[model samples]
Target: MSITSFSFPTSIRFGAGARKQVAAHLLEQGLKRPLIVTDRALGALPVLAEFRSHLGGLDVAVFAGVFGNPTCSQVMDGAAAYKAHGADCIIGFGGGAALDVAKVVGVAATHEGDILEYVWDHPQVRAISNPLPYFVALPTTSGTGSEVGRSSVVSENDTHLKRVVFSPKILARMVFADPELTLGLPPAVTAATGMDALTHNVESYLSPAYHPLCDGIALEGTRIAAAALHTAVTEPGNLQARSDMMMASMMGAIAFQKDLGAVHSAAHALGAVCDLHHGLTNALMIDTVMAWNYEAVPAKFDELAHVCKVAGGGAAFVPWLKTLKASVGITGTLASHGVKPEHIPRMVEIAVKDICHQTNPRPCTAADFERLFQAAM
Candidate 1:
């Protein structure tokens, strides 16, 4: 196996009311003005009011147009907003969508190039700019760990092609994980987001990389999601379950950064064409991809036997995934997610283009993606 350097994490502040301290944190870091990038749904007066108060008139500005599957144009718009506001830092304040958008804005606002030029595997000889102002994150949901990650995924508006702008400069200088902020999520939203975390764990554990660090983190993340997703889904008020799922979600992001594989590659493609929620799409496709991965790494699946071992003693990850999917109300397939058979060819082409595809334990051509999409359907 080839050796690789593995970086650990960004600074983090946990527990309730951590968000209330954002102002002081920024003050100590010497950030005078910051852009708070969030989603429209979270921009509602009632939602943004308290968090806004946290900034305490430190010249903080808001740019909440960020939507689902953050697009290149949208990220550019965010970059524009950051420049217009004379912001010197970023505060990501919503789900993964908002987090990714903020990360991109931080990179693009400072760097000089087409955003995709810096994407994984994209051909462009561009270098990062000087220390890109700092970043602080307050994830309103569990996470994609946009706070700790070195890259941010954005979809192209013209083609809806998902690409990532990867660099350690995009990582948050500090992250605030506050459970109280997630209490308002609807049941379906909770389920979808939780399942997205599960996908990351599964993908990370199955990654072909030699990083045993990511493997252990992914395995424990999977266990936490399995133990807590159902409770978090059914009983939204359960604080312990909520916190566990949130931590698991961050761990999912950390683990997958080692590398995500076919599931993310396929999900990114399907998300573009279907205009589907990434987490929900992952929920829909998790079982199919897990089954495909089963043949490639039965022993790895066997190693994860304990995660789903309760249902079938010493079972592979497949049976456990199926049982977990049904338990969390994620029994649907890609077809159920509105992916028609005719969509397979196009989705396949795009999936192969995704950066994550390279990390798949099994190398996939367009033909392989078509086969996976057909099976997913």
Candidate 2:
């Protein structure tokens, strides 16, 4: 198999068996005792067991308490595990939630006070001044791209509201992207996560940020997702489609360094108030949010239409999104996914306060978010 090594935002080793390089990579970084962070479900899978077997003679431990929509407590627990095991580095070995927790744990392990004290935007929180243990990310899914991101989204244990821990120091030292790891994902998960990747690309491109480099990357990422998401969902064993989607997902994360828009703002709110999967929330709300947003940036949608190969430019893009969502078996309204009318007020409150809304092509208000939530329902 051909392997490619490159760095856009982080060092990446991309190929079919890139995960097999994890041991050597860790050794190169002088990590002898590494703590593997992953979700409980994935930790139980044979794939992980098989992976562990490959690390002959190295000290390794697993922290598998990470749950969906990871909480700050999980980060603390993982950090405790890191210290107890005398780990020298962190290996994030699953999807976004697991990887995010691992990133936070890496920082929290070395810092003092509660983990929340380091959350972004908290006035009392101290800056993350200390360098963290080395991080090596291995993504088992082709979305979120948290493996390459510098922020980790953790939810408040009491309120379940999403909070971000942002710092350039949190970026991974190395990313081992292996498409073979994603081949076992269920179709629904593949579809939802693929749409999440698409949303990232679309929202980043539509953001009003003045970064031409991110604009070009976001546009190409959109095209790659539009072309490969369906094939990856329908043919789970197709490594080529999986590879393309993985590349698109990484590009989307890199591009979003420019900024994201209302789609993520709304999705983060949903994840907070409704306890929904981040990517699935993005997938379900994308059409309604983009439809309302099209008038604000019609020219961007026109460009998006061309990239997505839809005729009629801006007017056709929403329909194209609907078509794409349906073809990949992603069908639902917000209410169908457990959101309620009474929840709209709080969701709107959280959404407008989200940092993502600041970069929206058109400014959004609480009222606008309420309407979007209503329409989504």
* C-alpha lDDT of candidate 1 relative to the true structure: 0.80
RMSD of each: 4.5, 1.0
Candidate closest to the true structure, highest TM-score: 2
Please write out the lDDT profile of model 1 over residues 53-86, one tens digit for every residue. 7778599789989887888888888889999999
TM for every model, in the order presented, reads 0.92, 0.98
Among the numbered candidates, top lDDT falls to 2
Clashes of 2: 0
lDDT of 2 by residue, 74-186 (tens): 99999999999999999999999999999889888999987888998889878898889999899999999888898998998999888889988998999999998999999
Tell me how far candidate 1 lies from the true structure as C-alpha RMSD in angstroms.
4.5
> How much RMSD separates candidate 2 from the native structure?
1.0
Model 1: per-residue Cα lDDT at residue 327: 75
Q: What local distance difference test score does each model get?
A: 0.80, 0.91
